[model samples]
Target: MTQDAKIHHHVPDAAPPPPSSRWSHAVEAAGWLYVTGQLPTDPDRPEAALPPGIAEQAELCFANLARILAHAGYGFGDTVFVRIYLKEFARDFRAFNAVYARYFPDDGPLPSRTTVGVAALGRDALAEVDLVCFRQSGG
Candidate 1:
């Protein structure tokens, strides 16, 4: 962040964003916010158990991302791009898509997206997601 630039650091009140962590949940600069990848683990309670199945895990990942965007005064409607990671692509891709559509509906401007299959994720989470957003003026 520079002195003449308006930058915002966020820690999503809804999810709380991993207490005292070294990384920021989201950072805003020049009307854009770069959100960090969100795992299915509960940021509000690190010790809490994770949700089972890809559908639930995928939903949680989006929920966590939503909180980060909301904290920074943005939303999915502001999103320009999204990236998703899946641990079991063969088994869970369809289920993940179903959950993903609920949050990112086709009725609106769909953000450009990429979904990658991964061997594993932090805390053994089945999925993770991150976003890049452009905040519209007065929105």
Candidate 2:
């Protein structure tokens, strides 16, 4: 099979990839989907205001990621790894976990994750996240 057949770029229908942006929302190849970092920007209203506070920002990040996953035939259960960035780690870490756990709750398999404090983020977003999702060769 050709490489294009092996790797599928999943651009969420809900949010068209930015006209001149430099990334795909997700790319699937070799049973894995590598998702791009997601911000809390509204898909329908890219210019809308963002909610203030870590909890809300974290929730939005996940929400945005979930949409991309679905478009690629993946879900939280398919996530194998994640990376999180926060403008204020010390102040938002605990609150961010409280919100994050809802997706990978105690009953679900929590993906490996690393969170770091960042000096800044685009649009000054408080948090941003990205993930890798996998599906077994046949499953």
TM, every model: 0.87, 0.89
Clash number by candidate, in order: 0, 0
Q: Listing every candidate in turn, what is its Cα RMSD in Å to the true structure after a full C-alpha superposition?
A: 2.5, 2.1
Off by over 4 Å in 2: 2-20
| Top candidate, metric lDDT | 2
TM-score of predicted structure 2? 0.89
Candidate 2: 10-residue stretch with minimal lDDT: 1-10
lDDT tens digits, residue span 17-58, model 1: 555566677877777889989888776785688888988888
What RMSD value applies to candidate 2? 2.1
Clashing pairs in 1: none
lDDT of 1: 0.82
